[model samples]
Structure formats: C-alpha cells, structure tokens
Target: MDYDDAYANVPHIPDGESYPPRWAAEAAAFREARATDRNDLGVSYGDTPRQAYDLFRPETAPKGTLVFVHGGYWLRFDRSYWSHLATGALARGWSVAMPSYDLCPDVRIAGITTQVARAIQNIAESEPGPLTLAGHSAGGHLVSRMIQPGLLPIDVTDRITTITPISPVSDLRPLLHTAMNAQFQLTEDTATAESPALMTERLDIPTHIWVGADERPVFLDQARWQADAWSCPLRIDKGRHHFDIIDALKDPVSPLMRDILG
Candidate 1:
C-alpha cells in the first residue's frame, strides 16, 4: 500500500482514555491476580534520571532473559500496564524486563533509544547470559535500535543473543507523513537516520520480524520493508490486528510467540 493508504489504516487513540479495550481488559485481569500469585513480580532495574525499567523473573527459572519493551509510538504508555506480558515468557523460565522512557517532544527518538540501551545494560550487568530483546510497535522500533552495530553501548550488544520485534515501525520516514508525525515530531532527516531500513548496513545480529495480517497497510508495508532489508525471517500472524498481535505472546503456542521464543 502507498503512504496514504497505509496511514489511513493506522490506529489512533486520543490522549485521554485512549488505551485499546483488549489491553485494558487484560491488564485488569493481571492486576487482580497480582495480589495473590505475585511470584512473577516486577522490579526496577535502572535509576537513570528520566528512564526506568521493571524486571520480571520467574520463580525457579531455567531460561535466558527476554526484555519486553512497551510501545506508544515513542510518546505514550507505561511499564506498569505491560508487566502482564512477562507472564508468558516467565512461565517458560525466561526473565522479562519492560522499560519506560521519556516520550517524544520531551525527548527525541534518539534519546529514547539511548535510554532503552541503558535499561538493557542495567539488567545484563546484574543478570547475565543469552538475552533476547522484544518489543511491540514503537517499542519494537526501539529494540531495533539496539541491534545496530554501533547504535547501542558495547556492553549491552555483546550479551544479546537474538532480537524479535513484533509489528515494529522499523522505518521512521513513513510516520513523518502520517498523523503520527504530529506527536512523533519526526523530520525527514531524523526519520531516515532513526529508521532500521536505512540502517540495515549496521544490523549485525540475528533478528526475527513479525507483523499482523490485519494491521494497517502502512504497518504491513513497514514490516515487509524491514524484513526485506534485514533479510531476516518474517512471520505473519493471520487474523491478528496491529494491537492484538502482541497479545499472542501471552499464548505459548502462538505463532508470534514461537517465532520469538524459538
């Protein structure tokens, strides 16, 4: 789809009361259960002035760490609401960390990506080995930043084994022309530099790309371009929308989950 067609299908939620209904419901369920089975609880890993991430480790676990970053187009959402995702990975003995960063305008995408690297470094320094990074939507875009050879701090890159970004906005230029630009404040130059598609020459790690079949054409296009550029394996979750595709991680057998976990 062209840029116009892709933007039209992009989902936009107003500032207040803007969360997706499915996320609200799932978050509610997780919150209610938190009081009881808090074994898989969350922890803050970084104390940076403007950035923080919550770590969720499984009790008596057996796998590597999997950091799940939340997405709000680099301007919305929090670590609290996304802790539930850790349950899926934790159940399989994988530790999960979700970091919160200063949104756009207040801090540009470059700054946000930097914070994400720090958050990962904070976790890796304390808990070592076979780390895999994953994120949804904007969060997915941020994780891609870490995969770039020189984009992330040296220490953080050495520990990561693989990366799986689900429904990521790997290419930032597309957002510059879409309604998302109003909040993202992306310039053509910034978009090109921040975009993973343009940064392909820098990708050095094995990465997996996945997107929902029902996502907006723009998102699908972005995913396609990202997969093509990286020459990485691309998995499509049939019938899942952009918002719901990430939820598949909650199910162990989900196509999205399997692609990343395996």
Candidate 2:
C-alpha cells in the first residue's frame, strides 16, 4: 500500500540507468538515417528553449500526422530521447512530430499540461492534417486530457482521428503519496482537475487505450479506467513491461503501430 514504492519503476528495473543513453543514441541514429526526411529539428512552440518540436515528414504527401509525446513523469526526458519512436508512424505514411516540454519543479503539472496543449496547437497550425496523438506514461495522461471538453478548440478536436495513450496515468490522486509529488506538487483540487479517470465528460473522438501486461497493476487499471470511462477499446500486450512496451511504437507492422496509423 506504499504508493511511493508501488509506483516507482526504475528501482524495479535493474538496467534502468541504461535507458537514457540508449534512447539518446537511438534517437541520434534515427535522425541521421532519415536526415533528408527530417526537418524542423527545433520548431518553437513557446518562447522557452524546451518548448520546441521536431518534424519528420515522408517524401511524398503523408497520409496524416502523428504527434508523439514522451513520458518521464513530467520531470525527465525530452523529445530528443524519443525521436526514434516516430519510425513506425513515419514508415506507415504519417508525418510524425515529437515535442519537448518544460519539466516539473521548473513548472507544475498543471503548467506542463498547458505546455502540451500549446505544443499540439503549434504543430496543428504549422502542418494541418488528420491528427493522431499518442503519449506514454505521463504523456498518456496528457494526450488524454487534450481531448477533454474544453481543453482543445472544437476545430482541432474535429480533425483528430484518434488518440492513443500507452500505459497512461488516468488518475493522479495516488501520486500524492509518492515521492514524485515533490516535483509534481499536486493537491486534491489540481488532481481532480487533471485526472481523466475521474472526469465524467467523454470525448467524442475515437480513442484506443494500450498497456503492457507486465506493467504495474496501477498502469493496467489506469488504462482500463480510461477505456471504460470513455467507452473506448483497450489492448494489453503480454510480456511487455513499462519501458519495453513502447518498443512497438517503432515497429511499422506491429499491431500497436497499425493502431496509431489507422
């Protein structure tokens, strides 16, 4: 029942420290491999340095666009670490845009939410197209929130074909017990406002919830909560843990990839 221990992931994963370097290396290689197709290395969405995104476009007209957000509990990682995640979407004929945001401690979770909204709007304005938004971990909660009744303008929501938040944290109340709250600084009011699981209003747009079977039970429950509350479909990938669950996003033929591209 210790929320801190229960939610902690890196401690349980022996090689957790290696993940950052691996992500950075893979993202660099992906950029190099797709040098020609890659543009907008650091497109500014806001005035800050981190408020930027990278756009990877296919040579021919893209079927649509996929805006990807990376999750590090709103405190770690950036768009650079997740560039390779665009691979599957790109190969499947979708332009992919990955965005970086100002982290927690520097800003509250509530502020980060707006930053994402701004980032998505900036991308939407720059390259308007049918949009499919996806995020992981904290990113999942973000993409999910973007579709809430008043979060994004109706025009933008109308253009979003689907939203896929992998291993999303639908509810944020539990995090108050975890050490992460130091950076997140959540209160009952803010948690209620941000918890998609607890929200009664449902988005009209289609949504697909995904979580790896091996992830902590909290994640599975969160994913189910969003699916049930929103009347959407959920997919569980057996044997995939929290970190590796995202691997499918880079595989064009993976069921997860097809789900996003569709």
Candidate 3:
C-alpha cells in the first residue's frame, strides 16, 4: 500500500488547505469576544514557550474540566487555532484547557506525549473535579497514551472520568512506513512502544473511540483498533470527514459534546 497517501488527509478533503486559515480567524474572534476575564491566554505549563495552555471558563462554577488537544500530526498548528472548540464544553459549564506542544523534528513524539501529560497535570492542579479529555488525530493518540499504566500520576488518573479519541492514530508501526517518518524518527521498538493499540493494559477509565464515517478508511480502522484493544465504545459520526468531523464540538447539544461531557 502507498502508506504516505493512505495517511495523507489534505489531498483527499476538498479545499482542505482552507481550513487552517478559517480556524485561525474563528479562534482569534473567539479570543477577542471571550476576553481575558474568563479566558486565560498563554498560561505556562512548562518552561518552553510552546508549552503554554489557554484556559476558557464558563459563566458559572464549572462542574469539571475538559481538556481538548488539537492535531497536526504532531507537526503543525497550536492551541491558538482551537479556542473556539471550547465553546460546547463551556456552554455546558465545563472549563476547557487547550495546550500547545513543541512539534516533531524539534521534539520527538514521545517528548510531546510527556508534555501533554504535564499540561493536563497543570490543569488538574488548578481546575479541580473530574477530568474529561477529547483529542483529535495526533492529539487522540496523545490522550490514549495518557491512559497507559505509569504514564500519569495515580491521583490524576483516578480523577479522569472519560476520554474520547477522535480519529486517532492508534498504531505507530504503520507510520514508520509513511513519508512523515523522517520527522517522527521511529524505530521498530519505539513505534511499538508508542502504540496505544499495542498496550496490554490501561488506566480502566471509560474510553470512547470516535471517527468520521466519511474519513479515510485507515482512520476508521485505527479507531476500531483502539476500541477493540481497550474494550471501549466507538462512534462514527455520519456524513463527516476527518477535516470537518470535529466541527460539532462547537455545538453544546451536539452528540459529540454529549459523548465528551457525559
């Protein structure tokens, strides 16, 4: 199989190149409208400049905290492009935290995983209550890794109520065959080691795998592989593709929100 093409998303999605700019505009508007009162921007979670997170709080006291991780295959984008996605969870009275991590070729995927864990730990320390996580694509893989034994503190893991990995890349072995592997630098050992689907045990938290019905077939397979491996539920949103499947996250009452917030 042509692994590079199989994993590629832009060429398949119509006008996919337009999404980043649109997301940037929407996120900028969201930040301006929400303001600094409830929206805390550029809060440092680590020493590095990229290791900051944006926190969006609701009107009333939050019932819990939801951490949403953005995806760019661990290469591109940042927390700034995804502030609007916090709308649904905030409308449901949950605080949302989005973190930016150092991308690949600058830092390895494993390093990125550790950074996400630290970001979540930082959020949990200040936010309180149950923790719900939702991540997209590469972010999905990161959230799934958090459930692996010893990856996170027991206190933090115990507070995690649920996790939803949307269009996650569960297995890294196949990625070694893709052109992007040059940036990933994964060996046979590291690929298997980083694969959440290859894990023998996880934190026992409730997990739900989500994929778009119209997404590339490999993503569907990846989601299924995680669901099966973790013995969790899986949802395929109808009429949605990889690029647009996460759009429902802006709707407070959308099924995707219900799945994440429930």
Candidate 4:
C-alpha cells in the first residue's frame, strides 16, 4: 500500500482543518444546553492533569455508561473537544464519559493506554455498571486495547460489554514507516505490543468496527483487517468521512447511532 496515500487525511477531505473548530463549537453549544452541574467534570483518573475524565448523566439513573475517547492520532485533542458526541447516547438514557489522556511525545502511546484504562477503572469504581467504549482514530485504538488480554484488571474488563472503534488504525506497524514516526517514536516491539490488530485472539466482548465509506482506503483497510482477523462484522457507514462520520453519535435517530447502540 502507498503509505502516504493510506495515512493522508486532510488532503482527502479538503475542509479537514475546519472540522476541529466546528466540533469544538458544537461541544460548547451542547454543554451550554445541558447542566454543567449534572456533569462530574474533571474527575481525576491518574495523578496528572490531562489524565482526567468528564462524566455526563441523563435525567434519571442511566441504563449504562458509555465512554468516548477523542482522536488526534495520539498527538492532540481531548475530552473538551468531544462533549457533543454524547448527544445521541445521552438521549437514550445512557451516561456518557469523555476522558482526555496525555498526548504522545509527552507520554508514549502505551503510557496513554495505561492512563485511559485507569480512567475507565476510576469511573467504574463509582458507576459500577455495564460499560461501552467508542473512539475515533487513535482514540479508537486506545479503547480497543482495554480488551487486549492482560492490559486491564479483570474487574474493569468484565464491566466493558462492547467496544466501538471508529476509523481506527488497528495495525500501528504501518505507521512506523511514515514521517510522523518522529513524534510517535515507536519501536518494532512497541508497535506490535500496542497494535490491536496483533491481539489476534477473539474477544468475549462484542467488538463493532465502524469505517466510513468516504474515508481513505487505508482507514477502511485498517478496520476491515481487524474484523476479518476476529471474524466479526464490519459496518461501512455510507457517505461518511473520517471527520464527519463521528456526527452519527451526535444524532439519536441516525443509522450510525443505531448500529453502534446495537
């Protein structure tokens, strides 16, 4: 595969940079409409400042909790950027938690994974119910790693019923070939260790992989590869791209949300 073509995103979606600012605006609007008091914002998962999470609830006791990990290729972005994504799941009586972990170069990818696991466990300590995780891009990889056999404690692992990885690069090995490796600093061993695709053992918890029809071939291949390896189903979200495909989570009635909810 052409590594450049596979990883190229902003070039594929002409208005790519605009999406982040728009998403930030939407998140702000979503928070204003909801009660900041109802949200258990900035609950610490780890010792560091970035290792905290925000948990937002519904009117009554939630059926379950759904946590969303925001994507910035393990380089940037955080919880504050994704509050709007809780819109659909919250409307369905689910509490949504968004956790921001320390970015790479500051903390390695594996370190970020551990921090996120800690974040989820921290939430579970109080919530104590079935949990679901959904993430986009690098965030997707982090969420799936929770089921990577020995990565998490059994208690936390048992509570996670489903994992939805949207447009995630399951295999990090390919990424090592790219110029961005300067920032990632992945060795062959760490790449394999952190790659969800290499977790070849099929998991007991159901895994739903989402890929956008309009996304670059490499993004589609990444999700498809993992599905085939695990013998699970893959959902190609029609007419969606890497950035906007996430909007499905913001809409309660969309097919994207329905597929994820199932």
Question: Which number leads on TM-score?
Answer: 3
Residue-level lDDT tens digits of model 1 in 1-262: 3554565433332232444555657765765665444333344544543476666666665477888888877877777677667667777777777778888778889888878887788778767667889998888888888877776667677767788888888888767766657777889998998998778466577798888887777778888888898888888879877766777777766666666677
Q: In candidate 1, how many clashes are counted?
A: 1
**Model 3 residue 253 CA deviation in Å:** 1.2
Where does candidate 1 stray beyond 4 Å?
1-5, 8-25, 28-50
Models ranked on TM-score = 3, 2, 4, 1
Judged by lDDT against the true structure, how good is candidate 2? 0.88
Best by lDDT: 3
Off by over 4 Å in 4: none
Estimate the TM-score for candidate 2: 0.96
**Candidate 1: clashing pairs of residues:** 6-218
Q: Which tens-of-lDDT digit does each residue in 48-122 have in candidate 3?
A: 999999999999999999999999999999999999999999899999999999999999999999999999999
TM-score of each: 0.86, 0.96, 0.98, 0.96
Cα error, residue 99 of model 1, in Å, equals: 0.7
Q: What tens-digit string does per-residue lDDT give for candidate 4 at 23-117?
A: 88988888888877778888988888998998999888888889899898898888988998998998888899999999878889999999988
| Deviation (Å) of 131 in candidate 4 | 0.3
Each model's lDDT comes to 0.75, 0.88, 0.93, 0.86
> Per-residue lDDT for 148 in model 1?
73
As for candidate 3, its clashing pairs are: none
What are the root-mean-square deviations of the candidates from the true structure over C-alphas? 3.4, 1.2, 0.8, 1.4
Candidate 4, pairs of clashing residues: none
| Candidate 2 lDDT, 192-211, residue by residue in tens | 88998887886788889899
